[model samples]
Target: MMFENTLAFARKLDAEDPLKNYREQFYIPQQNGKEVIYFCGNSLGLQPKSVRKLVEEELEKWQNLAVEGHFTGDNPWFTYHKQFKEPVARLVGALPHEVIVMNNLTTNLHLMLVSFYQPSGKRIKIITEKGAFPSDQYALESQVRYHGHNPDEVIIELAPREGECTLRTEDIISTIEQHSQELALVMMGGLNYYTGQVFDMQAITDAGHKAGAYVGFDLAHAAGNIMLDLHAWQVDFAVWCTYKYLNSSPGGVAGAFIHEKHAANTQLPRFAGWWGHREEERFQMKKGFIPIYGADGWQLANAPILLMAAHKAALAIFDEVGMEAVSRKSKKLTGYLEYMLKSNPVMEKRIQIITPENPAERGSQLSLLVKEGGKQLFEAISAAGVIADWREPNAIRVAPAPLYNSFEEVFRFHEILSGHLR
Candidate 1:
């Protein structure tokens, strides 16, 4: 498809977009009196208009039913988390029993590590990408320390080749192969937060298993942004936050996936709570922690109803439209953003796109490596009604969310950006 730089052309594309109407579902932020072009979905998505209504229903149930709300309400609090099984599983291409909406991403990551990261004699090392999200890095460091191992010795950080912005799949697979004898676990962000590079999860999972190690992904950026098949890929486990592409409210309740193979293993070590006990036996309040059948067994507490309400409201949109359609528009929208950025000769000299050029290897985000005054440029765009993200040192990250962002807004962004290139 030929992409033209003209606003008229952008409007034509938006006019033709099948998902354009869905934009009305969300409340876009405003600057002064005008709506801003939001490109920060990678950081936090805009609120869905339906959120308030859903949340109010839950509040009404609590007020009307009191303690009986657990069993009496429309969406009973007793089994609230169960409703998401089908939709969340469908969203990430996993079996319903393999997925659970529960605690936040890092907490779930710790639970996954407890079960999967069983380091043993001679196999005490864990492999992960260099510059992982700080939460992951901290979690790995603390976990290693808990097990009486030095983080420097137990954790192997794989880096991109010098001058390259992202890791090559070959390099990642070879790194797993190189330390096969000592590798206990392989964990990484499914889509890198900074570079916006989507890793080959299937390849990485296969390589990790071949090396006799467990594989997991921190899907904080991947879950709703890209098409994932954790079950098909045989990833041991995965976790993701909902506030970004899933568009739940701020710090929304998160989700986790455990392949049926692992989820069914009741004997697997996990930090369990009463909510994870078998439903039939839960009220009995017995001594032994007899786990539930699958991913539900990993839950540490009862659902946070309000947060889950927001999540449910947000996921309904995905359930209606489907991930395949969402992914298609994401590729086209992000591609247009890249094309618009690269079309200018001045930008060629001033900015470098650090994200993978191949649509298959990236999500909606494109990280621009500004040659100079990157933060100042980011502030300029922000001041002109563009809500983008800036990471330390240089890059300005922009994500044209397919769910709400329009092609015309992307063009407007390019126009605003071009004005400040000097």
Candidate 2:
């Protein structure tokens, strides 16, 4: 696995990559008529080439069938979301009945919180990571307030130890234990959006359960980027967006997973809709709510057919490649990115990587904390055709998605960055 900071070495790796052909399956964006080295999959994944046709087919169905599309198309709009269960379940390592494709990420998070974030009497605190994605922060804070509790008192945010950029698993577990008496929910991002640190979900879930708390994860950054076994981890619930890493279109339909143990509990509180009613009893339009027996019970509305079509197109690629193969290539691709960045003398002095160095503790992203000229450097790379993302203040996040990004592109980015640093 020796890596050399040379174009030849990068090309060699690209030639050897089993997933190399996947690059052609995506429509890479162009700058001045040339393809940009796209490393922003952590933000928005590149569109799959098949997306247009998949979406068009749905359009054609609507055009031809109109209202009849609901029950008559090849994939009936009535149950279009059902087709996603198996692929998404496989992607996140859950039982087919345990997962469902539904609303956008934050909405689903709120729905999950309604059912799982019950706070009774003195046990009413929620534990989450500090500097979480703003949507998560707002969701947790608002949910606390809705229950008539003060956020400062009811929410405990675990911070990284001073001088470290990522949360240590020990620190997280200890914090749960520290507030065990009052902890009602333990929720965190499976991967930190800024630092790209992958939390130990199984450990966190076990610790939460032992402390008598419901455990959930916001897998917005982790779902398609890493291997997740939500069921085996005994996670009570989880939610993720499809756009990033999953490569569905912008604002694609999001997904949720509820462990079978929780899914069968019909008495669980939720904000339900008719789509979540038992299929056989749904058309009766009775006054009482009869919930579906699994994760489908959490659905708030019928499927968004077009969004589901886009999601299906991207997931088909994941199903074909399999997460195991994707994980293997991801480790090597991201490792090469890290190696090339470190090997550049100018970069070594000008930037610091905030992401975890261990592959197991991270996914495909590397968050570089630029020491000087951060904005200018980011702009320079952009002008040079490297489409990486810049967060506020100083960090530049680059993710080499295994499905479409290539090793040579990573090398070219380093070359562009090195030239800019000079």
Candidate 3:
């Protein structure tokens, strides 16, 4: 679709958007008594207007029911997390039993590694992308150390081909095949946090399996931003946080997915907890740890009701519109953002987009690399009521979220940025 750089054109697209009403569901942040142009959903999403009421209802249940709230509320606290299964399953394209809302992303990653990253004999190596989110890098390094192996020898970091900003799928597949003999696990972010590049998960999963390895993903940036098919892709496992594109409150409950193939395997090693024990016999308080049959078996504790409430509020919006619709709007929103940035004569000459140019290779985010005065440009935009993200040493990341961001805001951001370009 050809885009025009005029306010009228942006407003026209906004008026015609099928999901345009969704913007009213969220509470956009205000700066100096005005709504700021928010393009930071890749870092943190705007809060849904319904969150307060959902959370208040939970508070009321606790106030009225006390200890009985565990089993007596509208959504019983005892089985609170179960309600998320269907909606989240739909989002990730998995069976209801394959997904579960649980601890934060990194904790779930460690739990997944316990079950899937068993390195033995000649198969003692793990492959991941270079410069992954810091938590992922730390998790891999520590996991290797915990097994008494040197990270330098046991972990392979795949880098971009010399001059490229993003990794090539061919390079990733070949890396998996190259270490096939010793590869025990292949893990990567579904959408890279820094470059905003969306990796080919299906291809990576197939290559990993053929290479005799377990595969998983950190979908922090991919979960609500892109349409995923964890089950169809045969991903061994995956984890994601809810605060970014999912629009749950900060530090909201995270989620996990374990393929059905592994979910029912009771003998799989895990750090067990009482909540994961078979529900029917849970109250019997038996000495043995009899596991539940699926992803729920991986739970380490009972649900955090308030956080889950916030998650529920946000997911209801996703369920209403459906991922296919959300993804369609997302492509157009980011495309407009990209087009406007490129059309700015000053910006086009002074900056470069580090994100993959193809829409299929990214979601809503576009990472810009300024040739000079990167920090100054970031500050100038911020002062002008544009809320974008800046990474140290150069890139400025902007994501025009489909649920709440408007095409007019995208055009306005371009106008603000153009005025700041050196």
**Quick one: how many clashes does candidate 2 have?**
0
Off by over 4 Å in 1: none
Which prediction has the highest lDDT against the true structure? 3
How well is each residue in 55-133 modelled by candidate 1, as lDDT tens digits?
9999999888988999985779998988999999999999999999998988999989998887889999999999999
Summing lDDT over every window of 10 consecutive residues in candidate 3, give the lowest-scoring window: 413-422
Please give me the total number of clashing residue pairs in predicted model 3. 0
TM-score for each candidate, following the candidate numbering: 0.99, 0.99, 0.99
Q: Candidate 2, which ten residues in sequence have the lowest lDDT sum?
A: 73-82
Return the TM-score for candidate 3, rounded to 2 decimals.
0.99
For all candidates, the clash counts are: 0, 0, 0
Model 3 C-alpha lDDT per residue in residues 189-245, reported as the tens digit of each score:
999999999999999999999999999999999999999999999999999999999
Best of the two (2, 3) by lDDT: 3
